[model samples]
Target: MDHTAYIAILSVAFLVLLQHLLGLANRNGKNKSRMRRPPTPPGAIPFLGHLHLIKKPFHATLSRLAERHGPVFFLRLGSRDAVVVTSAALARECFTEHDVAFANRALLPSQRLVTFDGAALGTASYGPHWRDLRRIAVVQLLSARRVGCMSGAVCAEVRAMVRRLHRATTTAGGAVTVELKRRLFELSLSVLMEAIARTKAERPESDADTDMSVEAQEFKQVIDEVFPYVSSVLWDYLPVLRWFDVFGVRNKILAAVSKRDAFLRRLIDAERQRLDDGDHSEKKSMISVLLTLQKLEPEVYTDTMIAAFCSVRDSFVAQAEIDAAVGHSRLINADDLPRLGYLRCIVAETLRLYPAAPLLLPHESSTDCNVGGYDVPRGTALLVNVYAIHRDPAMWEDPGRFLPERFEGGGRAEGLFMAPFGMGRRKCPGEALALQAVGVALGSLIQCFHWGRVGGVEVDMGEGSGLTMPKAVPLEALCSPRAVMQDVLQKL
Candidate 1:
């Protein structure tokens, strides 16, 4: 080798080494500048941190902590540092101003197992991948037009529920006492499955049907087992415990995820077969749309992504609204949703009181940022306590009381603090479909039946422990066909 070439190579290597050192120094200096973290509660233990302080119905526990530490407080949950935002102002800061910074999801062990390592829409991190999923959801699968097309399926399933209820009442020779949680869950699941896979038989027959396909039954059973444990699992917060499989939490998650993945794969394969059969019908399911997109962009839309795409109650001032607006002349349909303003209010109020996910799905900060004038470090998990914010005395008048009329005059105002379906970029794309389904189902039930509390007792409004924050005691009510809607009920 020539002496000149050797010297040139050495110079290049020296320059690269110098640049690497400089980058490290810069990062170290940045870390040293340590901005003030949010105020943490007083009772953090040594290794457990605030884990010991956490109790069941976590949102309420956090709300009590926020009262002492202020709206935004920090907590060290095992190895992870979490920021809980309990007030509207702080929530807006995290979701609106610092939305992108907090766009990534906290990668819990259970979430990774279920979401295929964050390939699914709800669990994906904040980046091009998440944006792509969101775009596909909003523009293609869950667009207003697409949801409107699927409205028929939603209505049909809701009617099926009503018919089943009617038969139960008739069989009992009057109003029958029935548990509502399972029925409502079945209706919601059926609508979702039909819209995604074009499959109606997947819906559970009676919440205890041995005749159902093993895969279908397993899928439902896995969901029931997995959701309640997502946040409650100790190993997720303390990784070391996973080694021992303490409480068998890790094994349970794995078993449930295995079943779930297998079921989803079957759905995808069936959808692919349908597509291969040259049946390009107009009323395509969400999976079909995703499959078509997968063909064009195979790298971006993988089979796991296709598999991931497949995935409420209210009461009485609603009945008056239905009677006056919809009347008993004919059954309420999707077109009538616009005119049923008060019905919408009731649904909104229900959400405010009981958001599907009380913590609004754990979000992780991508970069150091300020929330409520306090520094939040990168990699800190953010739990926007929408449940706390919704029921904050400062935000809502008589926060515990149900007041659908508060939302009557106008919809949610700009920066007015309501985020039942979440807010900003990561807000749930299924909001429209959810509201529409709930509105239709609730409206139909109220219109067709006169619901009463069993044994003349007020319905137990206690919340259950789970990701979705369901009613602790499943709602059991006396449902009788309304005299006014007898003609409509008879036709069904």
Candidate 2:
């Protein structure tokens, strides 16, 4: 070949190689650029932003994130935006300082249909109507006086539960695998119902006694399958879904809601009939109080309004279902109240560990503000993870241990940091009733039985999803009569 021809061929070959190398460099450069972007927090894998974190239990994922990202961090799950708060200081800010600003609940799709246009106090927006309804709820249903008056019911139910436990133990060869969660739920339910029903005698154990394993399992299944899905309905945020109602998800919820609403209507109707017939007295129930308000102030509050306000429909009654299925012991009646300190501690601990509203009602910033040094603009959705805060090591001495003594006297639970009921103006009005019910129940349980785990492994204190963090495994315990050693309990 001629020298010029050789040089031309060589030049063409060089150009081709150079182009290939440059293309490779650009591709590699793009890959490196992507890698350089801070790996989206811990627990996230390629192409999925924090999806793996949610697959595991919620508490574990949150605990892991808290460890890596300090107390607070931003997260996204399938296009949903969230900020997790894990410290008491931040929780305090969300609960108190930011109370009014964050009072409005982030509208949940499931409750929107069921809550009578968001009229229920728990899900309602912060407004004049909300304030008025809350006022009535606190004064009428959840007031200290109302809860205190229900002490007799608490005593009655606890005694009944003890009697049932005694019967089960005697019947089952002295060792019964009694479901503590359901029993406790029923106890709480009985008191709440009796308080609402104003019933004097102990409520009858249902034909399908909630204590039985089959009924307990069914109750749990209904809650577990139905609740979480309903709460996170895809349509709430996505407007496009509204036109077609999106994927038939709304229909399923509506069906479930209809069934639930029917159950509540029956309960309410029965209560109303008693009032109409003059069978109810000054010892009126919370429902009756609501009915009275509706009658007296027909303009502001009507029967439907009262029903929406205080009715133990699926939204509220499901809590009782969950409480029963989860196996906390029943609420103690008045006679056993003195000795059931541990039950109170358990309720406190449960609230701490598995906050009913872990993130709490999402608060919208009314105006631009700086919280924890980050600029939070108005219209931002604020979430405070009470679960993370309760278990914070800095705030708590031994956060994970189910130690109730920390709250015993002038201790960690007695001050600013301890608020399971939330704080400030938008605080939960049901605080008084929950405390009274939980305390009396716990006291009675301790007084009546010697509670210990059934499987012998430490009670699996693992938590599950819900409005409340319930025991992953309902508490199954062997209840032995405490009356034999009543003298010792009396001393305490």
Residue range 1-492, candidate 1, lDDT tens digits:
999999999999999999999999899678746777788878788779999998878888998898899988899999899999888887787877998998998888867777788788898998888888899999999998998999998888787888788778777888999788878877777777778787754545653322223443556777887776666677788888878885777777788878787888888888888999996888888888889888999998888888877601345566777888889887787888999988888888888888888888889999989888888888999998889888988868898988787787784763346888887888999999998899899889888998888999877899877667878898998889988888877777
Q: lDDT (CA) for every model shown?
A: 0.82, 0.62
Distance from true location, Cα of 253 in model 1, Å: 2.3
Q: Alpha carbon lDDT of residue 118, candidate 1?
A: 79
lDDT of 2 by residue, 242-350 (tens): 6886377777777766665555565577778877888646667777777776677878766556667651122123233333333244433443434444345556766
Model 2 TM-score, all chains together = 0.75
